[model samples]
Target: MLASPLIEFIAREHPAFVHVPLGLVAALPLAILISFLTKHARPLTGTAFFIAAVGWASSVASLVSGLLWGRQVNLIPVTGYFPVVASEKQVLQKMLQLHITASLVGFVIGGLCTWLLWRAWRREDSPGFAERRHAGRRFWERGAGVPALVVALLWLGSWGFSGKLGGIMVFGNEETNKAAADADRAKRNDAEADLPIRALDYASLEPAGAAPERSKAHGDRWRRIWVTASGIDDYQAGKPMKPGAYAVMATFTDEKGKPGTEPGPLYMKETKADGSTAFLFYWARVPENLRKEVGGQDSVYWRSPDPKLITCLGCHEKDATPAK
Candidate 1:
């Protein structure tokens, strides 16, 4: 389902018109045939006319709706993924463009059909309207009916096929993609079980000058994440991680040129050997004064040990098993 209002409207309405063009195509022929059998069959001609008019109206509706719908769906998402099946995509695009051409063709055919039906009707009351009008009216009727029907069929068929291909994009990959995701996840799980979970040593920094070296190396990658920063956390990886939770905060330049900030914290309850959870907390933040603070402050801002805290599930929960 399209969340965007414009897309939603197009998606909803295209189907509505899909049937209209086809229905009118079906009704138009019946209308012309009945009119020829008896020019006085005003009811037949009127019904056909109504069908032709509505059919053409709906056909136009489908054409416009499809175009708008296509625009919204064809947008690039910015993620660096290549488009699959480029040629096929282009082919489908051409078909949609052709849908518009077909629509105009339908309009012309319907107009000419309606005009000929009227001409046939006018000959009805002219007592001898029959003899002189028969040949010309038959020709016009067949002429208008065949091509109009073809236009509707070809146009609607193309739109329908294009719609199916688009649908396959969002919802059709489920069977194959889901299976692949499941298989990859299973392999990862098997590997994590054999991997060693290393613990971070946050206690030592100044004596070894490891802090400055690490600080210079990573810069402000992790904001305000120093080992002795106000609120701190420690984790041991080889063993089940300590039951802990932490908030990762960072400063971002906002639209007004002033620094804006958002806090994203991850909470974790360590699992015991028996698989039970022990809840503990570790909150992280880069104080406003420490704007230039490097590796010891922000998550992703710095990358040294003292200023780093394992993110929930990101690092702490990564590599739980051995390699395949």
Candidate 2:
């Protein structure tokens, strides 16, 4: 997954690549104006050259950002995942990589074009300012320059579209969430900070009809769990869990492995909602009833709100606080 460096780069590069090119387009006309008004296009030449330089730099940065983001998202398929039936995923990968590579080439060529335009604007050997202005226009004349311009512009437009999706990857989608994952983590960190050293009375800790909730030292016990979703940052998928979020739910038992009021396996199920879907979940009260283990992948998490992967699907819906 892409990390903070790449994420920040993307957030900054999109806007820069978008606006910088317009300066070049405008500066060409400015060259003609300056020449006619003041008998010289020298200032316009410098302005156009500087803008082109900056534009080229930003363009390359955008190209790199897009590709890195592509790899982060697994936009490219494994060579043998599915058969030769290509999907939109393949098409998107090809288009994105093509634009990224093409943009770099454009940056280089756009630079030379700017330099040429600069030289043309600086040409003032003509009889009068009017004649010099005509010379400035010819400076923009390039060998297949218009076609290259089309490529650059088209690549930039494609960059914008890619950027929209990339933004979703770097920053978590907020519409599914009531608040940010980091904000949820903050609440959990606050909870951990307030965790009492000695256990409180179990009855006092829980509300009526709620099974007693207690905490023991995590003591670095790792559990197996699947990663439901992942992205470059904590915000995207798992951020909702909250800080110090992991917890274990092994069933409580007597020596005979009978039920007791201790930890147990988390059970979850779906609830029907008016439009789409919802969830309900609770702790399994009987230790013997637990399956001994819930199968999961070996997942490494960032600073997360939900540790222990407690938010198992179809199980803990009843236990979760309102997802605010």
Candidate 3:
């Protein structure tokens, strides 16, 4: 779903807000334990109540922010990797359910305990209610406090797991890319270190239109393609790159930077493994780094073992040749 600019900004900044509540709630159990160990029970209980109230408010804020952020995310699997089209949808729903259930339940329990503590404090303030205050204090400190602590612990665990799953969903592909590289290190090394020196005239090649200039493919970077003479020919003819030597280069600029100035990375696709053609992807910041990596070979760069990891396939597979 397309998110509004305000929603997008909040979603992008959700991580920072989430940690605040998580930290506040996490400190509650330790404070309770210490209050029991020492005799500073009255002050600690008031502090715990205040912390719980703030934590509850912050948790609500974070949850709302996360939902707003989720609007921009693809919760449903677009590819047929899942058993059902809504498998990811189901998983996300469950995570949200667990997180919400744990948080609200903990908040309610902590709130009840806070009220009990407040009542105890009020009794202590009333004149000639020493015995009543002592009884109220014992009831809350010895009884309600234990359950509240347990609920806080459970909430922490539930939220931690939910956050872990969310992180895996977002950044998990890097692990897959690393595994592929490890599985075929020799092939990857050869592809990166030894592609043919088929350079394209970056200055002369026609720049890709605005449609292909922006993507989340390179993690919030601006990408512009500068195709080779042969690449342009194949693209015009609605054919793949001919099963021969040639290079296609892409220059990445920071999201706000100009086309060539402050270029972040250089992506080069070269023909590798001939006979019904396959292309390998290479990347580097400067030609010097590429040369150093490949033993002083110019145009040498580190190849992407999995193109999807580096988001090369989305454009290359679709836009390189027009579909019938």
lDDT by residue (205-314, candidate 3, tens digit) is: 64544443544554445666655665666655666665443444455545444344445445555444352324444453345544443334343344444223334555
Name the top TM-score candidate: 3
Name the runs in model 3 displaced over 4 angstroms.
Answer: 1-3, 76-85, 88-144, 173-324
Each prediction's whole-model lDDT (CA): 0.42, 0.38, 0.53
- Can you tell me which runs of candidate 1 are displaced by over 4 Å? 1-7, 38-40, 75-89, 125-324
Listed in order, each prediction's TM-score against the native is 0.37, 0.34, 0.42
RMSD of each: 15.1, 15.8, 12.9
- Which one wins on lDDT? 3
Clash pairs, candidate 3, are none
Candidate 2, position 83, lDDT? 18
Q: Rank the candidates by lDDT, best first.
A: 3, 1, 2
- Model 3 C-alpha RMSD to native: 12.9
- The alpha-carbon deviation from the true structure for residue 45 of candidate 1, after best TM-score superposition, in angstroms, is 2.1
Deviation from native of the Cα of residue 298 in model 3, angstroms: 45
TM-score of model 1 (CA atoms): 0.37
